[model samples]
Every structure is written in structure tokens, then in C-alpha cells.
Target: MSTAPLLSVDWTDHVTGRRGHLVVDRLVRGVASGGLRMREGCTAEEVAGLARGMTMKEALHYDPRNRYVPLGGAKGGIDCDPRSAEAYGVLVRYLRAMRPFVERFWTTGEDLGLTQDLVDRAAAEAGLVSSIQAVYPLLDDEEEARRRLADAFAVEVDGIGLDELVGGCGVAEAALTALDRAGVPYAGTRVSVQGLGTMGGATARFLDRAGLRVVAVADVKGSIVNPDGLDVEALLAARDAHGTVDRSVLRPGDREEGPDAWLSADAEVLVPAAVSYAIDTEAQERIRARWIVEAANMPVLAEAEERLTARGVVVLPDVVVNSGTNAWWWWTLFGDVEAEADQAFAQVRGAMRALVGRILDRSEAAGVTPRAAAHALVEERLPEIAERYGWY
Candidate 1:
């Protein structure tokens, strides 16, 4: 459990003095998979931890009957705000510097501050064939796999791309599974979410449709709280490319509060789908929700989770919750599922529910938190995967 990875590279952009890092946690079949993120405070240690989480995410989905064997974990991050004017140039330069790795081992897409289109654009600018082309060598039919994934990405549901919805679909399913186990009916269950971007927005939509009341949602502007659920679709439609909602779309009854107010909302479930370490010890004190579903990576700090656990609040780990996006890509490309949305959704739901159940079961049996239970599950799988493919 040392945070050591197989390889780590740090790059400094010449033009703006910005830094970037990539960490390959482990390798399976000569490749690793994760995503690239751009944010101002990114660092090598953060990327390394994320890479380790990717390893866990990949290992958790392993199955002998499935064609999509998980690859090694890896991640890339750049220190620049995505909204900054020079962000694109920094991204291209970082990709250019890491081109060798992208063409060989690390297959990445969007994460946190970056989008798929932006990553694809930057990858192309860096002279790479594709952001994921490094894994094409492992495919049965490379061309067919490429076309299928492209088609899958092209398919959109209710104006949002299919790729954006799967992760949220998985997150919502995890929450529902937790609620079901506790015998809590979804009809009156209230939920609050932080972030209105791809993961959070999609989660709100699905949870609302699943009979949960989405009472509050926080974006960069502020938290929009309405006692009776806000209009999920309208807010989603009103968001800019950066996932910030236009203030003009707010309803007369919606109360706008500070960014962190969502933490204290009167809801059974709270989702931190935006930034890492958002719920520190101070913020954790404000959360009254019975369940904190992590749709974002490392949103709950260790100390805060310890305090929350003592208070009997369940903190679902991101490795299992937000893993649907990564699993979907491999499932589609590996031909286990087609590019269609319905089949993709069914697969994600089945996989997430099973994983959540197992984690919670293990939590009770082992007398550990759900995050610890998930870590134990990954620990169980890593060896099996290693035995089959040998360590990199």
C-alpha cells in the first residue's frame, strides 16, 4: 500500500511555467488506462494517488467471463485552470511531452477540469493517433473497436452525450442500492449534490427520475435550493460548456446560497461530485445526510471520513461509484456490450449494484467502512489479475 507507482513523469511548460505529471500505477497487457485533468493546483502526488485509484477501479471490474480484462492504472494532470486563456496551449504541450507514453502505455481521456473533446483536440495537436489508440494493439479488431467507441461517444441522451451519463448512472445506482438495503423508499428520499457538470448533472437527472427529490445542487455560482426539487432538466440545459448554470434560469422560489451550503441541506443523501478533498473535517461537520455518494475522486479526506464514520454516516468510495465511465469504455471497445445506450445502461446498473452490494456486505463482515471494504475488494482482485498477467 505504499503510494509507489510503476512510472512517474513530471513536465514543466516552457511558455507559462506550468507543471504536469503522469503516473502509471501498474501495467497489464503492456498498457495502462486513466484520464488527464487540468486544474491549477495539480501535483505529482495527487496524480499518483489517482493512478492508484485507477488501478483499483480497473481491478474491481475483473471477470473471467468478460472479454474486457482490466488494464493497469494511470493518470495525468496539469497545473492550470481549464478556463484560463493559456490552458489549451499548456494541455497540447503536456500531451506533446507525454506523446511517447500515450502511444505506448497510458491511455487517457477527460478528468476533472478537462473534457473529452478538449483531450481529443489536445492529443491530435500533439501528433497522437488517438487519446486511446495505445490500447488498440490489445483489441481483437482495432478498426472495429475504434468505430464502435466513436459511435458510442456520438450517441447522446436528452442532449447530453451517452459518455457523460454512464458514470452518473452508476453513481445513482450505488445510492439506490444503499437506500434499498436500509429499507428506505426512494419516493421521499431527498438528495443534495455539489457540481453541475457531467457527473453531477447526470446523477441529478437520474436520481430525480428514480423518485428521489433533488432538493439542492451546487455549482460554481452557488447552491440552488428548493424544498421541492429543482428542475433538473432546465438547469442542465442552462449550463455553459464549463457546467456553470446561468443565473437567469433560476426559479423565483429557488434560494441561492453560498457554495458550501449544499453540505448542510436537509437531505438523506449528499453527493460531492465536483472537487477532491471538498469535505474536510470542517465541511464534514455540516453534512447531515445519511449517505455521501462520491461521484468525484477523493472528495472525502481521510480524517473527515473517520469522523463521519464515527457519526454513522456511510461514505461510498469513488473507486466503485464513479467507475462506470471507465468500465463502459472497455466494455464497448471489448465487445462485451454494444454501443447502444440501453444495453450500456443495463450493464452499468447491473455492475454497479453488484459491486455496491458486495462492498457493503464486506463492510459488515469485516467491520470496516465502505471505502475500506472497497479497498479490500481491490486487494483481493489485484493478486488474481497479477497472477494471470504477471506484474509490470
Candidate 2:
């Protein structure tokens, strides 16, 4: 609650010769949950910051309306390139070493540069079970592999892949809620997405399906823009296994020269679903979107967010927009998964829309940003929770 992590652990993978950090911000009801990220230059401070955000996210999500599932916040990060051959070995050793902490204190899933398959494989090799899997026996490694294969083939595998569906679905729900609150129609609304990874790609696909024009999408390689709207399905089909859409598949007019082109594309909504600090000062200056639905954690920097707020851009914080995945996780862990994945997705979407609408309404009433309003809401409840647990 004080922004200082309750616990921090530095780990080294002796096998692959990599190092990482794990930070737990708080423990509510003796439980914490978050993702493990492996990026090129991840840092301990970054993991701590993400852990703080996760704490705030869990606080914001489990209000009185929902039967409080007391989950705390934690995050893990490794400063290694997951694309390297040594990556798998590094993960196996890391998980094996951290098995005790993971099983007892913090549970982690996939984040940037991490896939469910990797988590499953690492957990399996480490002889550890995820906290969620411990509670719900259905979420085993074989089932996870089946779900991954189903995702690859675009097949429905008995709702085993609901967790993946919720992230993008939640982003689209946030975007739609923002547009509706602003009195904008979805049919002709233009959207520009930065980062064509899992979250961004899902956001683009869902928004395009919802009748919004996806004008531009960018990845690490470069950007492509078509003012009329790009074919989301075609782009998905043409994308490489690494989630990069080849520029060669694009027409001459569709290609954008730089990676940051999506920042300046003509659109009403901009969804930054990539890495953190995407909307820096320079990006803030070039942004043309009136609304930003953050699909990634802390994609916009503090100064850039302030600038966007001053420019009257309605920036939806990631705490609200991206919390759907957490909601889905809770639902799957507690709710009956015998139901269809679409049904679960619809439930999560409705909850997200309601939460977003409430946050926006409160922000408007208080004449503050949604981020501020949501944080205030969480802060108001933290004292009672901490007092009950003696967290101070």
C-alpha cells in the first residue's frame, strides 16, 4: 500500500545463466497473483512498479458488489531474451528455484515475452502447480497445451481458453464504454493500435468486429495504416508465428515507415497494448486520438498522461481496462467452468463495461481523470483491509 514491496526476491538461473526479480506488493487473505515477464532489459524496479499496479488493480476489482475474492498483488521479471535457445532452460531453472515461493506466497502467469505454454512447461518441469490450478484441478498442463493448440487452430476447446479471450474482450469493452460515454458511435469510429502482440492483436480484432475501423496497427518492426480500415482477419492470417504482420503483405499506401507511426495516425481511439512507457513525451505530442484505452500496463508515462489529460483526451487507465483478465482468472478459479467460454467472456465484458462506466462517471463528477478517481476509490478501501490484516 505504501508503494514499497512487502517482499522482494532476487533469483538466478544457474543453468541458463540468467537473473530476475520477484516483488510482492501485498498479501490479502494470504494470497497474491500476477504475471511473470521476460523482456530484454527488465529491471527490479520495473517489477516492483508493476507489482504496485497489480495491488491497485486487485483492490479496484474486488469491491463490495462482488463477493470479495481476496487476492493480493505481485509481479516477476527476468532480464533475458526469451527468443534465445537458452530461454527454456532459464525458465525451468528459475521456476524450479522459486517453486517454494510460488507455491506458498505468490502465483504467477504469463506477461510480456511470456506465453502460457512456457509457464506450463516450466511449472511442469519444476514439479509445481499454479495456485489457480491447485484450487481448480481442471487447469492442468495438458489442458493448457490443448487450449494453446485450440487457440492456434482457432478452435473452441470447451472454454479452456477463456483466460486468453478476456484480455482483448476487456479492452474492446473499455473502448466501447469510453465511446458510448463520449457520445461517439462505434460504426465509424477509427482506432489505431500500437503493438500487434497478443493483447493488441486481440483488441484490434475485437474492435474491428464491433464495427470500428481499425485504421492502423504497429509492432516492433514497423506500422501499417489504411484509413479506410485494415482487414483484421487477413492481417491475423498473414502474421508470423512471432505475431508480426509482414509489411510485404501490405500495399504501397498501407505501409508506414517507422515503428511509432501509429502514434500519429488519424484515429479517434488509440490502444497501446505493448510494453510500458510507450506514450512518452514525444509520443504524447504526436497523438491524435481523443480517447486512449490502455491495453498494456503503464503504457503512458506520468508526464505524458498529464499532457493527454490537459489536451482533453479521455485516457482509460490500464487498471480498469486490463483488469478483465484478472476477472476471468478469478472467475475460472471460483466460478463453474463447465459453462461455455463465450458465456464467461460475456460475463466479464459486462462487468468491465459496468466498472468502466462507473469510473468515468465518478471522474466526471469529481472533475478528475479516471485514473485518479479509480485510485481514490481503491485508497478509500485500503485502510479497512489493512487494519483487518494488520498490514501496516
Candidate 3:
């Protein structure tokens, strides 16, 4: 069977007379949600691809066994530079004009080159809410991070930390799923997380508190390894704006290495929590862990995943593994947190469990890789949607 065709898009703002693109790559039977990124050189195809990812992500979360097709994931992008204030105003106007799409069909969330402030402004102009802020906690520049810790913790039994602070709900769920599949107890499992950005930092804090060994962590500036276990509390205390670990403050003999070294470290699990397509074909050959969890969106490429599966590595795909943030966004849109913590966590947890089960079952039955199993699952479910709609 042929692959699904890309959604047709109209790339222009009817109100501003500016060029923008609407890529509706997939359709949920009812509603579709995804991020809308604005950047220079953003193309219709890029938005479509991202939308396609969201469709698969939503599907994996909603129906892990591929029993139901993925709900529609749609992403929109405006091709413009972000350096000028004029561009921001134009973007706001563009978003306002796209309110119809936002309200009924697609939901807008933050992505690369977009900030919470920008998201809030655009959302306000369009009379919509920011998905990233809704799902993930928003620490306004004016809000004290330490002061909000209590409020964040009050929401759940577990006290809020850097995990909830940076908000890697997706990566956290992914790590939990990986541990389940490996039969490795979450407590005391050795983990090495690369890229100490929002996702990595959040996942590290959660895993560390949950009893996992965060032996090594890295960021754009540098990498650090502490096989004996690093003091997360001190690290969090000294963390810089970009969540960089201050090397000067380390308590002696804390080995520092280049970023690439983390991938080769010995551990039960490895999470590439940075950005899309970090684990490509070349990097796949260096991976030495039993389980790989993708915390970032599209962190592992298809070709690389295939290679790793050939080597007996069990990989959890980004679609399901990194969907906590997306689920949280949906929850906030449809439910309230104060009244629905159980419901929210259940939806996220259930999705993680179902996706893991489906992958394991399919892999064992066919003697195939988990990545392949997930691919097969998504493929089988895609066509059924068109059938239900009786596409012409």
C-alpha cells in the first residue's frame, strides 16, 4: 500500500496579506492538536511532517494497540524571521486571522524559536490558549521559581523539583515505559541522559528521585559523568539559565568529557532528550544500552532505529514515548487540573503502558524490532481511517 498523502496547504494570511502555510497532514475523526511554529524558512512540507508526527503521537496515545487510527495531528508555520519586533506584530496578526483554524481544527503550541511570552501574546490576540503552557508549567519571568515549587508540589503527592520545573512529562513517561519493558526496576536503574535542556533536566530530576542512577548528563556547553552518582540538589542549585551544570562548583574528581562521550557510556538506559533526529545512522552504531527512550520529538531517525533494532536494542519510539506533554495539553484543554489529577495522570500512564505492550507483543510475535513493530502498528491503522470516511 502507498503511504498517506501529505495534506494540501494554503500558505498565506488572508488578513495581513503575508505568506504563511497551513499544513493539515493528518486528520483525527473529531479534533486534531499540534504545535504551530514560526520561523524563517519554515515550509509547508516541514509543517506537514510535524503534523504527521503529531497524528501518530496522538494515535499511539489514544490506541496503543493500533486498534484505532491516530487522531489527526496538524501543524502550521509562518515563514518569517523572528529578530524584529515588526515580525512579532505581523505574526500576532497572522495568528489572529488563523483563529478559525485554532478554535475548531488545530491547537497551537510552542516550538523552536517561539517563547512563552510570544505564545501568550499570539494566543491572546487569537483568543486561544497556549498548549505548551497548559500542559507544561509556565514559570513567568516575574514568578519566583522557588516560590512556585510549593504550588507545583501541592498538585501531586510527589514534591515538585526540577523535573516538574523544566517539565519533561513526555520524557518522564518514556523513561518509565523503558524501565517497564526491560524488566529493570525503575529504582536504582542506571541512566545516562544527554542534552541537559528542558526535557533532559526534567527527566533527570524525576529519574533520580524515582531511584534511577543519573550517571552522566550534558548540555550544549559540556558534559559530565559521575558514575558514583552526582548530587542533583547541588547541581540544580548551581544550574545556569540554560540549565548548564557549573563545572567550577563540582565537588572534586567529577569527570568532565565532551558531549559525544555520554552515548558510549555503559548504562541500562540512554535517553537522548535534546532535539529531533539526534540519533542518526552514524550515532546508532555507538549506542550500548539495553533500552533507548526518546524524550525529544523525533530524536531517533527511522534509518538509525532500524539499525539499532538489528543490533537487538529495544527502542521506544517518540510518538508514544514522548507524548506526556501532548497528553497534558489535551487534558488542560478539556479538563481542569485541580479537579482531575487522577484522570490526567491515568490518561498519560495508560497511553504509555498500552504503547509499550503493543510494541513488545508485536516484536515478540514477528521476531522484529520494537521500532519496526511500532511502524507496522501505525501503518496498519492509518488506512482504516480513510476506509471509515469512504474517501473518494
Candidate 4:
């Protein structure tokens, strides 16, 4: 339980003068798993925090019976807006500079401000075999595993890739599991989602399909809200690469408000599915929702989570709530599940539901937050994993 990361590196892009950081929090069987993200103002501290969260996320899903034993945690971040003309070059150079780690130690994929396809392209342009090449050595059948993961990535549901939907699927299921445990009805429940991109859009869609109303969804531009329910599908379809919804997609009854207005929407559930550290202590006060499910990593600050817990608002930690996407990648790559959509969805839902149930039960039993319960679960499981595999 040391707080120190196993390794940390900072790189300066010579062309754009932007900086990128990498932090490997831990390693299992000689490799660590995480994602690379690009955004304005991304820092080493933020990347370190995300790497630690990846550790917890991996440990939370540890199962001895499964073929996919959780790998260790790592993360990479670049301080540049992904929309900038030079961002792609920055990403390629960053990958090139980190090729040694990518080859031997760290397995990564797309995160905030990037997509898997983009990462693959950049990695290829950087003269790399694959973004996740480091994990190939552990696979039982490397060729089959690579093919399976590629097929899984090619699978799409409702116009969104399965990889993009799994995390949100897990988030929606986590929310539903919490409601079921609390004896709350899903029907007519209102959900306000922040971000209409991959996570938020998929989460809203799943919740809507499950009979909940997504009353409002905010993008980078502004909030599009309709008390009755905004059309989640339409908005999702209209979103740009950055998750911003096009204003022309607004319906007759939808009202546009400031970007931060989703915080004030009257809803039972609020999903922060966008950037890290989005909701601060002061911002948490504006939220009227009973539950804040973090579909994005580190969306709720620690102090804000403490205050929200004091106010009886349950904040589902990112470590548990947003882990399905990562888990699905390994599940496919490690042969626990096939490349098929139904199999992947079934595996993700079953695992995420069970994990969330455990977290909530431990929360009530120990009189602690779900995040605390999740951390405790990780603490218990990591030792077990290390006992079997030895910490690398």
C-alpha cells in the first residue's frame, strides 16, 4: 500500500513544446495496463492519480477462476488540446518516445480526448506493432487473442463501438444495482448526464432503455434539457468526436442552458461521464441528485465526495463504476470471452453488477463510502493476486 508510483516519466514534445507524462503505478507479470489521453493542461500529478485509479480498477476485477488475471496500473497523458492541428503529431511523437515501455512494460489504449482507432493509427505511425503489445506475451494464443480483440473492436451496437459502450453499460448497471438495493423504482427516474460522448451517451441510452428518463445532457457547448426527456439517441448521433452535441439536434421542448447547468437539473441520478476533476467542492453543492455515478475518471474531487457523502448523496467511485471497458479489453484479449457482442455484453454486465453489489453491501455494512469499500476490496484482492503471481 505504498503511494509511490513504480515509475514516472515526463516528455516534452519538441515540435509543439507541449508536455506528456507517463506513470506506471504497479506491474503484474512484468506488464502494466492503462490508457493514453490528450487534453489541455494534463499534468504528471493527474496522470499519477489516474494510474493509481487504474490499479484499483484492475484489482477490483481480480478473479482467480478467470483466465484474465488483472494486470497492474499505468497511464499516459499529454498537455495539448486534441483538436489542435499539431495534436496528432504530438501523440505520434509521444508514442515513439515511449516505444520502449510500450514494447516491454505498458499496455495502453484510448482514453479521454482520443479513440482506439486514433491510438492504433498513431501507434502504427510511431513504428509500433500495437498499443497493447506488452500484454501479448501473456496471452495463451497471441494471434487468436489479437484477432479476437480486433473483432470485438469492430463490433458496434446502435452505431457505437462495443468498446465505447461497455463502460457506460457498466455505469448504468451500477446505478440500477444501487437503486435495486435501495428499493427504488427505475421507471420514471430522472437522470441528467454530463457529456454526450462515448460514456455519457451510452449510459444515457442504457438507462433510457431500462425505463429511466434522461432529462438532460450537457456537452462542451451547453446543456440540452427537456423535463419530459431529451432524445438520447438523437443527441448521441449528433455528437462530434469530442462528445459535444450539435445544437441543431435539439428538440422542440429542449431548452439550452449554460454548460454547467446540468448540475442544477432535477434528477435522481447525475452521471459525470466526461473529464477528470469536473465537480469540485463548490460545484457539488449545486447538485440535487441523490446519486452521482462517476462514469469518468476522478470527476468528483475527494473533498467534494466527502461533503456529498455527508449530505447523503452516494457517489459511485470511478475505480469501480468505469472499469468495464478496461475489463472487456482484457477479457477478449485473454480468451475469457469471445469477440462476439452478446458474449462480451453478458460478461461485462455480470461482472460489473456483482462488483457493484459487493461495493454497496460493504458500504452499508462498514458505514463508509462505496469508494472506501472499493479501495478495501482492492487492498484485499491485490495481496491475493500478488501471492499467486508475485508483484512484478
Candidate 5:
């Protein structure tokens, strides 16, 4: 409901010719956290939108009734291709310029075009610590498992990369929850994912493992489809470093080329996990899926959302669907990780399932779209919190 951003900054690297924006929607508990994305044609407005979504996500997750975690929403973007040779230098310069902000108020992790390794290196070069890393204990061997006990707390610390699994698992669980709310069976359900990057690939793999058929997956290069369901593991293994699935690795009959092939795939669930505004009005017309799980931020346009709602399609908002990383951060910092890494993942999944189910149920009860219900839930508390803290 708010049209203005809390904080927005644009910066450029004179030497590397890099430019970017940082937008913080709100500061909760004196801190705001989100991811730094690098992609061609990214804009400050887009970054601001993502930052706002983060605020909504955190507000809902940490609501007094839910009490999942306490965080605020923010996002940063660099308008450059990470594949370019100058990317490293650009990232370093960006980090250096934003060092003060990163340390004082905003903490960012990896997003679309950026990798966790790149973010870690950039943060190191900037002499700043990642927010998530700050909470984790320093381990010379990430693979070694160590258990520690306190007066009332015991936890196991392992080097396993739990953050890597959070987003995908969250998305998959949200989708499953939506299906259950709609009384749709997961078994034999077809899914089409509109990106094969970290979030998208992980979503596809998780859904496939959960007995949903991932019938199609798309990357920037193109799409590949098989009604019988693509080999999720094989496709993952065949993906290049850039996350593009090699067409050669697919069966000869599975390959398909079209700007909108993935969007039109015959499936029950469609996940737009690659880019923003993937399902505009025109694209929405081509959507055959009953459910649209937004794995990417703001993938559905407002008009498209309205249209989809009128058509009885359930559009899960990105804020709720992609809260896995946020939940993972909260759990790593506060929850008991004494069990295996999978236990942490299970916790996140269960949380997402409950949240999604509650939102969908509220929407149906109110005769409103799921997005409206989600926004209402967040807005109900955000204004009061903002007023109480004099943030408005």
C-alpha cells in the first residue's frame, strides 16, 4: 500500500564502470537484510520493489502470532553481467563503496546473477562480514561436526551448506501447500519451472523428489520438456557453470525452442523463478498452470495477478514462497541445529507449509486472491510497528 521507499541509493564505480542501487524498505531491530543481485538491465525501481517484498516477508514471518523470525527487508542490485571478466573488480568496488552501509544497517547475500562465493569474497575485500556468516561459528573444517552444550541449549555445528538448500526447499514446500489447499493431488501433477538457476533448479529437483513431475525447465538459452517428466538429477548434472542446461544432455525429443515455450507448458504448477515481471498480462494469457508459485521476486505483474485470480488461478506471492533463506538464517542463529542438516530443512519446510496453508485458507474464506490475503496480513501489523517505532 506504500508507494515510497524508506531508503534508496545509487552508486557507480568510476574505474570499473559498474553501477547499482541499494534499497531498504524498513529497518527492524536496527537492521535490514536481503540479497545482492547482479544482472543486465537491472534498475533501482526493481531493487526497491524487491526490498519492499522483503519487508512484507519478514513482517509476516515474525508477526507475533507466527513468531518465526525477526528480520527486515532490503535488496541491492548491480547492473552488470557477472559473466563479464570485469565482474570481480566491479563487485569489489561496489562492496568497498557500500561498506559503511553494509556494516551499519544493511546485510546482503547472493541473488540472481551473483554467487555465494563471489559475495563472500567481495565482503571480505570490503572488510565486512556477511550477516549470516557472523552468526555461524568459525570452523577450520566445514565438514567436521561439533557439538556444544550450554545450561539450556545444545547444538550441533557442521560445515554443511544448509543455506544452499533453503530457498529450493521453501519454494517446493510452498507449492505443495498451495496444492493441498486447492485439493489438488501432488502425485502425477505436472510442473513447469521458468528458470534453471539455483532457485529454479532446486525447486525442480525438490518437486520431482516429492513425487511431482517436473515436466519442463527453462533457462535463458531455451526450454526442454518431457511429459513423462525430465530427469531432474541428470539435468542438474548436465548444467553448465552458468546454470544453463545443455540441450545435448536431454533426449533428442525433449528439446524445445521458443521465447515462451516454458510458459505454455501443460502443467499444474508454474514457477517463474528467473526474472521479474515474467508473467505480464500477455504472458498470463498463455499460462496453463492452475498454480503460479513465485520463486522469483515480483515475477507476476499486478494486472496479470488480477487476471489470474479471475481465472481461478492461485498465485503464491514471492515473499512467502521464497522466505526459506530468511528462515534458515534465523534458525542458524537461534534454533537448535543439534540434529542433521536435513532437520533444519524440515523445520523450514514445515513452517512454509503452515504459512502457505494459512494464507490460502484466509484467501478462500475472504473470497479474495491469495496475494491480497498475504498483503493484508502484513499490512495489518506493519503500519502499527512503523508508527510505534516512529519509522514512518
Candidate 6:
């Protein structure tokens, strides 16, 4: 699709009795509605770009009869960290302030440091009901898999258990898809997952249950690697309230307490699920995994993605890996828990497998990286969708 202006968007900060202008860019409205993004350094241009990306992402994963369809994407930005109560409150207020606009076309979800509780708080303060609640599964349970997505415009969550479950399930499905495309057997495959928050931890558990050996997993504090595979169930059982695994409870192994330790683990598959740009130039050189799947958005920088691709490392794009959050919004909003889980797991796995296989095949044919091919595919689809809607 053409990278053209879609919708005009602007951000104004009126917290200190004076308005502070941030970003004003295009908001591309597709078939229905779009996602809302919250970030620290979000520019009007960047957020617009993300909005456009959402347009393409939704078009690629189209669902009819929903206003908050993937086809239409909306986003928001707050210059605050989602981890702090004060910052979170401020963001929620900002979101409430933006409700006039949010009510018009966008469905808000958490992204990048935003939490479900924060999203709910913001919606409540604004007297705005979550679109998730008006829909299916969440309309029934609204607690588990159909919870709020906080950061990254429907990517992060405050306390949405269902959202996390679905997101992780999507990543795992994408990983399995890439593995199948590469003719790599995932059963008994040694896997290492870095970053054990909602996305990382959930993906780790899902993959482990799928019969893959979860050899190593890490979080903010530290990393634990066992070549013989760590029992994810046991680790999850011991996880603390903050999602940190009490290292003292696990059987000791060749453990390390550094950010880079996760890269050195002996594994066939490596999933970087922690943070953005986690894999750098130096870390890329030392990576031992034959396949790398990014469960985290932009976990590998553009440069690192290039190097890994050059070395024949198959990296599945986040566009494919972490789509569960988006899918959950619809499922939770429109269906039951059992139906939502079944559809989410099936969708991510099936789509990942298909998308990876197609991208890899095209990459081989065109002598480009899988990442490049994935980008090309999305780019191709976006413009077509836009044109179909008479946007261009």
C-alpha cells in the first residue's frame, strides 16, 4: 500500500493550564474503526504512520460486521511511563480528555507500558465504555482473555488476563508457523524466550505445552537457562505477583543476571519478548538460534534484522507474531470464552504458518530477507485495501 496521508491527527497537552502541542498527523479510517496507541515519544507523524500500519494490519486480517475492525485503526500517545501510578493516572486523564475524538471512530487498547486497569480507569473517568465490553466474550466474562490491552495501541494490558492469553497464543502460533515453513520440527525443539511479561511468559507457556522444550526464559531481573528444558508450568506456579519468577525457588542452573544473557542460551529457536530493540548489533553476532521470532514489537532493530536475515536466520515479523491482542478485542467483544480461545489459537497458528511460508518462499525467490518480504507483502496489501475504500 502507498505510504500516504490517511487522516489528520493532532495531540494537545492541556495539563498545566496551558496547551502543549505534540503531534498532528493523518488518521486513516478504513472499513470500520482503528486502534489507539499510547507512547512516550509519539510524534503526530509516527502515530499517523502507526495508524496507517494498523490500517494495513487490519486489512490483512479483516473481520466484517465490527466497527473496531482491523481495517480501521486509531491510536493515542502520552508522554509518560506506564509502570508508574502517577504516570498511568495522567495517561488515563489524557485518554479521557481525548474521548471526544475517541468516541468518534477509534477503539482504545493498551500498548507499550499501558495496562488494562489504566485503560479501564481512563475509560471510566471519561464516561467512555470500552468497545471490548460492548462486544461478545467480554460482554459475558470481561475478566479473563477478553481483558483490556493497554500499550502499543491494543498491544499491552494493565490487568487483562484474556488479552495476554490471546496475545501470547498468537505469538506462539506465529512461531510455530515460521517453524513449519522452514521445515523445522517444533516438537521437542529447544526454545528460549526472553522477556516473561504477558507476551513473553504466555508465549513460553503455550509453546512448552505444544511439546517444544522451553530451555530458557528471562524477565527484567534475570534469566534462567537449562539445556534440558525448564518446566514452564513449574516456573509459572512459582511466579510472584509482579510476574517475576522467584529465582530462589527453581533448581539452580547456569544462570546469569544480565540483559544479554538470554542471547547466549543453547537453543534452536529464540524468542525476544521483553522490550523493543533488545537485540543489538553485538548481540546479533552471538545469537545461536537457527530461527528467531520476535514476539515483541521491534525487539530487533532494523539493522539487526538485516544482519540476522543475511545470516539465514528466519525472523517472523511482529505483524504476524503479536496479533492476538487485536483478535482478542473482537473475540472477547463478540463471543464466548471457549469460542474466543479456540478461534484465537487457531487463527494465530494458521495465519502465522501461512504468512511465514509465503514470505519465506518469496524471500528465496527474490533474494530478500523474510522480514523484508513480510514488509513488502503488507505494503502491497495496504494500498489495495485503501484503494478499495476509495482513500487513494
Write down the TM-score of every candidate. 0.99, 0.90, 0.74, 0.99, 0.89, 0.79
Q: For model 4, what is the alpha-carbon lDDT of residue 173?
A: 93
- How many clashes (backbone atoms < 3 Å, residues ≥3 apart in a chain or on different chains) does model 5 have? 1
Q: List lDDT for all candidates, in order.
A: 0.94, 0.79, 0.64, 0.92, 0.78, 0.63
Please give the clash total of every predicted structure, in order.
0, 0, 4, 0, 1, 39
lDDT of 5 by residue, 153-180 (tens): 2332232234556688899999988777
Better of 4 and 5 by lDDT: 4
lDDT by residue (47-84, candidate 1, tens digit) is: 99899999999999998799898999999999899999
For candidate 4, write residues 1-392 as lDDT tens digits: 66999999999988879999999999999999999999999999999999999999999999889899789999999999999999999999999999999999899999999988899999999999999999999988899999999898899886789888888899999999889988999998999999877788889999999999999898888888899998888888888888887888787899999989899899999999989999999999999999999999999999999999999999999999999999999989999999888888889889989999999999999999999999999899898889999989
Model 3 off-target regions past 4 Å? Answer: 1-22, 37-46, 63-71, 77-100, 112-118, 125-170, 236-249, 335-343, 379-392
lDDT of 2 at 295: 95
Q: In angstroms, how far off is 371's CA in candidate 1?
A: 0.9
Report the alpha-carbon TM-score of model 1 versus the true structure. Answer: 0.99
lDDT (10s digit) by residue, model 3, range 235-348: 766665445777777767578888777787777789887656678999888888888887766777889888888787888777667667665544333332222446555655
TM-score, candidate number 5 = 0.89
User: Can you rank all candidates by lDDT, best first?
Assistant: 1, 4, 2, 5, 3, 6
Q: What is the lDDT of residue 240 in candidate 1?
A: 89
| Cα RMSD (angstroms) for every candidate in the order listed | 0.8, 3.9, 7.0, 0.8, 4.7, 5.5
**What is the lDDT, from 0 to 100, of the residue 115 in candidate 6?**
57
Q: Write the per-residue lDDT of candidate 6 for residues 44-121, one digit (tens) a residue.
A: 554554555455456556544433334355445555544444664566567667665555555556665555665777
Best by lDDT: 1
Candidate 2: tens digits of C-alpha lDDT, residues 71-103: 788898888887888877887877788787787
Error of 5 at 231 (Å): 0.4
Task: Quote the lDDT for 224 in model 5.
Answer: 85
Query: Candidate 6: global Cα-lDDT?
Result: 0.63
